[model samples]
Target: MAWTEAKLIAEAILEGFERHFRLFRETTAGAQARFEQADWPAVQVAARERIDFYDTRVGETVALLRREFHLRDPSDTLWRRVKVEYMRLLPQINQPELAETFYNSVFCRLFDRHYYNNSYIFVWPLISTEHLEAEVPIFRPYYPARDGFARVIARILRDAGFERRFRDMRRDIRCLLLAIRSRFPANRAIQQNFQIAVLCAPFFRNKGAYIIGKAINGADQIPFVVPILNDPEQGLYVDTLLTGVEDISNVFSFSRAYFMVDTEAPAAVVDFLRPLMPRKGKAELYTAIGFQKFGKAEFYRDFIKHLRYSSDEFMIAPGIRGMVMCVFTLPSFPYVFKIIKDRFPPPKEMTREQVKEKYQLVKMHDRVGRMADSWEYSHVAFPLDRFSPALLELLDAECAGSLERVGDQLIIKHLYIERRLSPLNLYLHSADDDDIRHAIGEYGDAIKQLAAANIFPGDFLFKNFGVTRHGRVVFYDYDELCYLTECNFRDIPEAPYPEMELSEETWYTAGPNDVFPEEFATFLLTDPRIRKVFRARHRELLDPDWWRARQASIRAGHLEDVFPYPVERRFRKDREEFPRRYPHLADG
Candidate 1:
């Protein structure tokens, strides 16, 4: 057959996406070995590196096309044909959605948003993931009725296929049975149809593997997770039983590191998980399991659909304006668009690339449930009429380099999309006393957790943090983020003379990374009531010694436990007063 240009381009793009997915799957497959060997550091490194795989492949493919096709500003007719050719190639691949996203990315990079539509790019997916079938079964169903509930639970744990032995399989089984009896649908009729369906793969993430499944009885089903821990000497043991939508979704929370799950059929895996976490969008679930590029594609399509249906205008996000980022959001949507300013003001002294690297650093690190996940995009277009006048003016003035007005649409050159959150400072204004207390304590805990994960939010202002739907506090500002070890935690030196304190002159010399924890109380706790409340319980947060101690522990190779759920959610026997470096495991 003669090689048509459209067919050739489609083939090359498909080849590129396949190469990327294959490499992604191979690295994901290595998670099993990493988990079995208790090689957590390697797992963390690989998870971070894997995020770059899609972009690396895209760059390579783009270069090849540019070199071979001389593909700069191709005619719209050619790209329309290219799109048609790509759709023809979709039926053969397992992930046509991902391939179309790749083609869109390659097409956008070659030119502009002149043809950012179904004609030249995949503004909407060309394939349907509904009723997708995998060659192998996506999940294994176990009948507790036949095998006995306790025995089935035991069998499932064994079926996890870990190389190490369970420390106390019998005890773990008893625990699981007790939790199931208590939390499982209690109606007697429902119990007759009770069965557990477990995903066929272990979800590996920072020192733990979660057995994701759902317990069903008739039309009602309860999502559950069996989180297992590993110890070098003790092998593996069940940590706790996490059931219900809230607990299960927390395990797959966007605030934490992505899980490395080996799978041949991602669409099937997602289909199984969608019911388990209905509140989490398909994009988030895909991103959670390490296919972030496809997640981006999902997010973009949803965003475009929302924009098309809604009449709301985009306005500045409600908060103190950031010096480094100009953030805006539609009134109806729950996400915000953050664009790095063309020029940062004084004190925010970093190049645009430097600021981007900071966000990248956060993306790779274990967020420890304190940092929000950001989805990045380039050349994103929206109708010019959708933007409020003030927002348009702000974007023009502050983010000119990141914006391009192309005809009736406003195209953002580069931007980050993140879940919208109520800024802590703003939320505290209207919050009741109990809520204020909760936010304050959570804010302190958030900082401590980040330190435990070797991360430091350089700015300690309340505005840098935000309150989630669940009232949990999370850090979103990353302009001044750094590794905890990089900062020198210190106390403010005593003024040489008492008058020097009044003079506001240099009482001491501070290095670039010097952090005076004591001063956090000064500017951060401006409200006397809030200050008193914060100091009463979390005074340690303002202590330099405590900060230094946490830094030292991180430096000594300690990986502190970061639980997504609250202390009350942990099983009673597994609960400990103090945080541990490693998780509980069973010895042979």
Candidate 2:
């Protein structure tokens, strides 16, 4: 057959698959009824047999395509056709009565979505290569063909309301992939956008169906975004438009300000500005209504109290240069910063917080756009207020590259700072839902965005970030943030990567046990909160056997902390007890 004729045949097969899937979806209700009445023994036998048949059929199809096209690379032109056919086979193979019962009872439901929504590009190797030739073997020793079937079955099970059934499936799947992924050379395929969508897909597919419904109805609009300039030399003015709120009154009660002291400014600049303090950011106009005062030294003392561990050295005078500080400590961290007001000698006793509370906090009624909930919800306040002239000068210098002021707001290009965080910082987890979602989303988007932008996060961890009031999560420490395409994403084993994944003697790529902290089990076991969140999100984190095995590894020295903090800073220091006091700095 000629190439054109072959191509025509492929297109016809692809269309057949698409039409078949559509019809299956349309008749799922009826098909489900017939499925339930099928004989149990016969169904199992048929499913097992079908698994073998499909493997042979699809695997052979993949092999033949490769040979016919003389394709040598991973993303050979031949893949486009192979993918279409494989996707077409999914509904037929997975929706069959026997397969449905087994498939819909697992956590691979997200994979089902991937198959349906056409994001199965990440797992294309499983369906495309017949030989499984790579750095890691694709087939399992104990269950060669069973591994692929299980993945398919798991996806079905996940779809059929059996997400909880495969709570530990992530670990197993990771192990299965580890046994296979590295068998090939460095992945010359596409960057993985797998997790980002998976993390948020469930919410959209199930509970948050409103967003989906609105989208389907063409009622939803594209999110509005304003570019945040990174250059301060542009101008000293920026007009940030705030929207996406029904009422701003609930949030505007707090003051806000951006302290822009020069890196070359006088050291006493902090003390000089101490008296004029609490100016609120325009974003927090509705919540501006707060006053407090503290001596510069006292402010640092109280700020230090919030450190869970002592080694967080960024806030210290050393890391903080020329007093251009952007401070917004969480409510749980304690109130240490003070605001001051302006006047002759700042009225002697006037503190920054007091001044901020007096004239900064503004009352507002409404807000409008895709404003992040956390951004609009947090009370905004800036710590120093006295030295407006010096502060303004510093702002001017930083903004020499790019700065602007629209109305009363100062818009300056602030540099994103990062740190080489201790690995211990990597293990700590937060219970905040918004934090979790944002972190996971960023991580997901990074694979694609970073690849395209030529940037990459050298170290990806849960604790490396915290949530802002507006629910935006930013990386504060830069130690591990680096250029994309700089790190290995393809050859690395998938998560839950283990050491001895396939068999005792069979070496593997990335497995669940690989690089996993042995103490992770103990940490989860000791902390009920960690257990709860892990169970709530990724249940595989809660398995005792897995934990025990990990613990054993820790004992055996198979696992060690990669980013350990300094020893002296490992333990919290004892603090002298003082009487429970409110904002005492307000008086004197």
Measured over all alpha carbons after superposition, the RMSD of each candidate to the real structure, in angstroms, is: 3.9, 30.2
Q: Candidate 2 — which residues are off by over 4 angstroms?
A: 1-439, 446-451, 492-499, 502-588
The candidate that achieves the highest TM-score relative to the unseen native structure: 1
Of candidate 2, the 10-residue stretch with the lowest lDDT total is 206-215
lDDT of 2 by residue, 114-160 (tens): 23212323221122221212322211112223335236423522433
Q: Give residue 178's lDDT in candidate 1 (0 to 100).
A: 59
TM-score of each: 0.93, 0.20
Give the per-residue lDDT digits (tens) of candidate 1, residues 383-416: 9998999999999998888877878988888899
Q: Rate the local accuracy (lDDT) of all candidates.
A: 0.84, 0.27
